[model samples]
Target: MFTLIYITASSVDESASIGRKLVEERLAACVNIIPSIRSIYHWEGSMEEDEESALIVKTSHELTPQIIKRVRELHSYDNPCIISIPITGGSRDYLEWLDDEVKRP
Candidate 1:
């Protein structure tokens, strides 16, 4: 199974760093970084807003746990936003390519 992990980072540089590490380590096949995004949420009983970067990681289900753990280790926020969504369907060629890029368990 394939999955997409959506992670929010403090800045583009940070996002790029994390993304690159994941790809280099074969924990992720690819990563798409959105340089800027506006985020609003509640934290520690307070509402907050900030500009952040969004990192979308493509990998396999088996790698999701390790990805999350690694991201937490590299992240700045105490509770970073890391959410994984299953890829139920996609182009067969692309999926196959992704599978090839990442290591299998």
Candidate 2:
């Protein structure tokens, strides 16, 4: 099983930090950082908007728990968004590489 995890960060530095940790620990095969983006949503009983960095994390389903734990440990937000979506289809070679990169110990 594979998943593309979506996470929002306060800045590029934080995004890099999160991505680095996940890759270093082999929790994610890869992490793509979108440096700047506008975000709008409800928070603390009110709607808010801000500029944020987005992290697109790629990993196997088996490592989600560890990934979530590590992300929360490093994240600045009291409640950061960490959502996962199933990867139903993808290139065989790329998917194989992903599997090899995030193999469970």
Candidate RMSDs in Å, in order, are: 0.8, 1.1
Worst 10 residues of 2 by lDDT: 96-105
Instruction: Put down candidate 1 lDDT per residue, 62-86, tens digits, no spaces.
Output: 9999999999999999889999999
Backbone clash total, candidate 2: 0
Candidate 2: which stretches are off by over 4 Å?
Answer: none
Tell me the number of clashing residue pairs for each predicted model.
0, 0
* Every candidate's lDDT: 0.96, 0.94
lDDT of 2 by residue, 1-105 (tens): 899999999999999999999999899999999999899999889999999999999999888888898899999998899999999889999999999998594
Cα lDDT of candidate 2 equals 0.94
